[model samples]
Target: MSSSSAVKRLLNYAGEKKILLILASIFSFFSTVLMVVPFGSVYFVIRELLTNANDISAIPGDRLILCGWIALGALILGFICLYIGLFFSHFAAYQILYNIRVRLSKHLSTLPLGYFTKGSSGAIKKILDSNVEKIESFTAHQIPDLVSAFLMPLIMIMTMFILDWRLAIATVIPILIGYFIQAAVFSSDSGRKAMEDYQHSLEKMSASGVEYVRGMPAVKVFGMTMDTFLHFKSTIYDFRDWAVSYTKLCRRPYMIYLVMLTSILTFILPVGVFILSGQPDNQAFALTFLLFLTVAPSLSTPMFQLMYLGGELQKITEGNRRIDAILNEKPIAEPVHPKVASSYDVRFENVSFSYQEKGDQEYKLALKNVSFTAPQGKITALVGPSGGGKSTIASLIPRFWDIEEGKIAIGGVPIQAMATNHLMETVSFVFQEVHLFHDTIEENIRMGNRNPTRQDIISAAKLACCHDFITSLPDGYDTKIGEEGVFLSGGEAQRITIARAILKNAPIIILDEATAFADPENEANIQKGLNALIQNKTVITIAHRLSTIRHADQILVLQDGEMVERGTHSDLLALNGLYKKMWNAHLSSKDWGLQEREVHHHE
Candidate 1:
């Protein structure tokens, strides 16, 4: 989209605060005018001295002192106006940014949970952090500075024309040439491609840097250096190389533009000499020519500033387009007449779901014709090999993605009819990967409930079998996690999440390998926590370690996105179907590990 459209969208977010920006621009415009008063004063003072050049004693000393004082006062007032303008602009910009961020975050909450997969997280963060920051930079700094930059030259050119229209016309020639040169360079296909490529490479490099930091533990364990992270290393090198090449390519053109600006006097000098030669006795004309020399070249700085701001505005507007992408994204549609689920039995009937669909090269269903009943107050375990629709089944209960064809219901009511908040309140999730905020342990647990007492937090932690461990820390529940705080082990972190779920105590629980990362001891402890959590709740769990779900009320064995075999543990084994084969394989894996250890011990 065009830059104006992008900027207009940002101003929409500014809402009523648009007034502050206007005020800022007005004040800055006046400030810019006042700032040039000192220069104007210099012109008058010089002309006065030159008029008395034949007799230095006839110089207007009083008038000269008044002019200097006026210059100083105008300079001081200009700075004051500048400060006020900056204050208003910054305050308005910050408020607008805060509103946009909050609105964007709330919108994100309404999107499908699966929309925030691990791979897309970096891009999302950039949109929120740096991309959002871009709009603020454009509005707060650039616009006001552009006002100043724009006005300075216009004011100087006007003053120049008043002094000597000939010199003023000459002064504008180099500026116009410089402007065309900048416009030509900036509007080039190669120039645009260079900027796009630079941004693309920078994002890649940033994402790689984040990945490297995240995988540092693995790298450290493997005794790997920065060079060992070849993808990251390559991205860094690529960014550096591209920057160097782009700079080298643009160097000559930019240098030429700078020459045109710095050599503004060269264009006006010959013209000035010609004018002076025509009026040899006009000492007043000579002084005015000298004043043009001083004032005209100074305009170049602001002219160059305006050009630079224009280029930066393009980049920021591009970033604003990304910000708009998120803002424009439609949130998950809410039901017109929202329904509530009185009973929490999750049923999936004739369900067909797929991440890939039409237009995708691979359109394989993750779940197809999968029907199951996870009855209330009983644990229904989904057991299968990887990619067999086990986790997909668990996720579907919470409506992460609407199925192409299915009747998914909670309490016999279609889930699509349920209000999003109602559906969320009805279900609690404990996935394989645990997420805890960088806050105190108490605060982390309190996220499950809007308002929980310290005692409530401790009580929930105790039920999840993490209270003892938490209390053992120096600060107890007050202890923080992640940054500036202690990091928990996989087991410990999982227990913390379990504690959060217990605190939430939703009637429906979806567990996707809740104990996947735990050690045997931790797994046993996690199971104890899960026991307390799933009591009299509709528990639909996905597990690879079939033994963990051996005593589940029901077992659904899936393969290739279809339910192949399903029954109670013993009943499935007796059928001698896929479930039985999986059970045997599970048993063999344990024996194989034991046998390998025994062989190693013998050796």
Candidate 2:
């Protein structure tokens, strides 16, 4: 995005709460006037005291009292206005920040699932959390301060010009020169590169810190010590080094600006004295010099404030760029005229897909010309070797990745035509990896449906065969799952996830070997529960164990991303194909186990 565009976007955020912003700007302007007025008041008071101290009529007692009162009032009012400006500015800033965060989150939810699949979670988290916070700091504190900084100097210079133009001109020359010098320093490619490097290093450090903390358990389990985690520490040191390098580059220009400002004042003081000493009217010269001395520092204050805000402004620009990238990403296409699907049977017609990567030409097709139908209200099982596109096919049904060629439909309606929420509402998937939030078991199940009553939750758990186990716990349904359901065993966690799906009560269900990790005892219970859950629902199950899918309505045999065979269990067995081979091997293992158990019992 262009700098102008970024500034416009920032202004737009403020414009949303124009009332608070207007109040802030008004108070800021008044604060600037009051702040600058004091410099002139002090100068005039000192000048009058020096020039007419002995003359009773030259400076009246009432005028002296009035000047003192006005000076005191301006000082008090300046601080009050500044306080009010700060309040309004921060209020508007936080509101804008809140709006940006909320908008970004809402946008993320609407974006294509492929966006998240291709992006790093850690990098996105950094942008949404830390980077957004940095922008907020700039908006809340530095931005308002910058406005006041600019206004104070301009007002001070104008007041000085009214007092005496020559001295005012001299005072501004140093500031102009200082500004150019600062600009030159920032404009250098090396300086910009250094700052960019520093920011990147900071991002890397944050990413590494998150990774290191998350992997600490694995690191310890593998007997890796604390020293192994020193990567994060080293990253912090690298960031610090980059920051110091940038600071060193800034030092010379900062010193030059200061020296030049001092030298300009020195040159102006003597020149003013020389011009005034020879003039018939020396009073104007004396007053001008006094005003110059008082106003010079205030005029320079704006430059320092600009320098302080400059770094923050750069960060805000970068942050906005990151945020805009996500907001600007194209969402997945949906059909113009949506087809309403009435049944749960899913079909893929000549479906082909190739993964697309940013800035890469080579596309790898994960599935090719795949066509199959999982009939409604029946258990259709898929048995495939690894990398045979089993999970890929499952993901496509939910439109996680769009196909390059043909269409996938539910009933007769193309899945693409279905709204994302509608698709998700109709389909429920339980993968091998189950994730649960850090909340009570009841709450987690309730997440499946917003207003599920206690009985609804218990009924779903009962359907998953987890209600008995849950009730065995002290808190029953109210038991906290901890983070990602860490407190639950693998089988228990899987059952909870199944319970969640049961609660959702989607028309179609996909179970990717849901009982693959369960023990024999738990597997039996899970099988019983799954039977109850799938009674009236269309089910597509991927099973590693051939025995589990023996009674399925149809079994598909896949190898290398292609369907090798598809038929009922008995038909495939009679054909003596891949399905028959797998079934025979499974039966042989079961017979061998039974024989061993019988021998042990006899002994």
Candidate 3:
């Protein structure tokens, strides 16, 4: 964060459109003095047509119509100062890229949802849409062509040293040796490590083309053809062979800065016409033909506007270093004096956890000195088996990922003292991959109470039985739901995510296996919409279906992460052990599915 503090945070996002970028840099410095005053007006109209060819018939006709109206008003004032300096440099680069995408989307809505599970919704959608459109192509076109490429080469080398200080010291020694050989071939750290290895092979070919178009329907329902899309066609041919070997290694220092700027403008305008034709001062040969026609088109117009803003200033310094690594990350702990509880229970006292990941540092507890509670208004259940930590104790009762050593309360305060949006507005989860948003099943059940109406989203989609297939589709609750809803069915997207956790009447739900992937008649209509959204709330439930927590009032179990066994369901099936071998293997698989449906109802 110091290349002069990343160029002063890209000039403080163009200092909030600093008066239309200082009136587009004063109309790009009077449009580079009307485009280098047409190379000193075609070198004084070819040195007055070769020194007034025998007084060109006594020079009159109103001075040849005042030199054709000052050469058509200097080509219409150099096309109206280059169209008002490219219309105020693209209106101050789209108002500083719409205020850095609204301050990085309001700093990603105050961060901390475990910073989006440590990145990768295609690498945070390629850092919020192609790295904030490469900082809006460097503030709307390479920062006004890098401030008119250093003010048109320092106003054409101070008007070529006031027109002939020995032909501006022989045209600034081959334009400073072709700008130090194009700045040693574009400041090579092997050409910025070949443009950061062609932007990490184009962000790993856009995160393997968004994981091969979202795993193309599970790679065509598992057949996985086209050679399993050969790692997304070899990462788009290794980003087209590293963009043709970084455009042939940037065309050898751009053809050696165009042959050292055409051999220093053809050897300083023929050695300033043999030292101004042995000048006896004919006004120093008309000021060395108007400073060699304003230093020969201001020597490649500021090195072609700094080589056309060197790839938008390297994608605006890699989009302000990926929006300053998500506005300087950190945030997770939060909560100072917060507290807002009003009845949800939860609690996990001598708790401990782990999981860390990125460049590890030894942390894998996944729950250790575990303790439990769940209480306030009933149903607990937890069971275990697979990895046993039971969904990391329901993701630490909503702190998502926290508990390193102890406390995790709720009704008795300490969820780090509360406010993580007041403990996710009194918790409520569901999970087992439900999602749902391509909008409108009453706006995804009014995103759990945005101002839910239309009869409170049809009474929370009729208490999550999903209002008879959402009023039988066809734009019932304004249909839509395509993307994540993918036209429903995993028991209608888990009863539209249990009618968005029963319109987020959140008092503390959790769920996790949420009827695992229902189907016994959508798990008896999702166990009657989870008994009308868990009647007294503070539920919990994790169940790998030991008959859906057989009316759980308390259970526990776990294994690797500790809590050996606890209560209910005939007191853990009268202590036979691991919840009576998981409730006698779910009542011997529901008594062989009711004896094969009573032998198919007697055939």
lDDT digits (tens) for residues 461-516 of candidate 1 = 98899999998887888887865557889999999999999999999998887887
**lDDT per residue (tens digit) for residues 144-206 in model 2:** 687787787777777777877777777778778777887787767786677567657877787
TM-score of each: 0.93, 0.89, 0.41
Q: Lowest lDDT 10-mer window, candidate 2?
A: 593-602
Those runs of model 2 whose alpha carbons end farther than 4 Å from true positions after fitting are 1-7, 53-57, 185-200, 225-245, 261-264, 277-281, 357-362, 472-474, 483-486, 569-603
Query: 1 or 2: which has the higher TM-score?
Result: 1
- Name the candidate that leads on TM-score: 1
lDDT of each: 0.85, 0.79, 0.74
The TM-score measured for candidate 1 stands at: 0.93
Model 3 clashes, total count: 0
Q: lDDT of candidate 3 vs native?
A: 0.74
Per-residue lDDT tens digits for candidate 3, residues 52-118, read 6578765455655566667678768866876776787778767777777787787777675667876
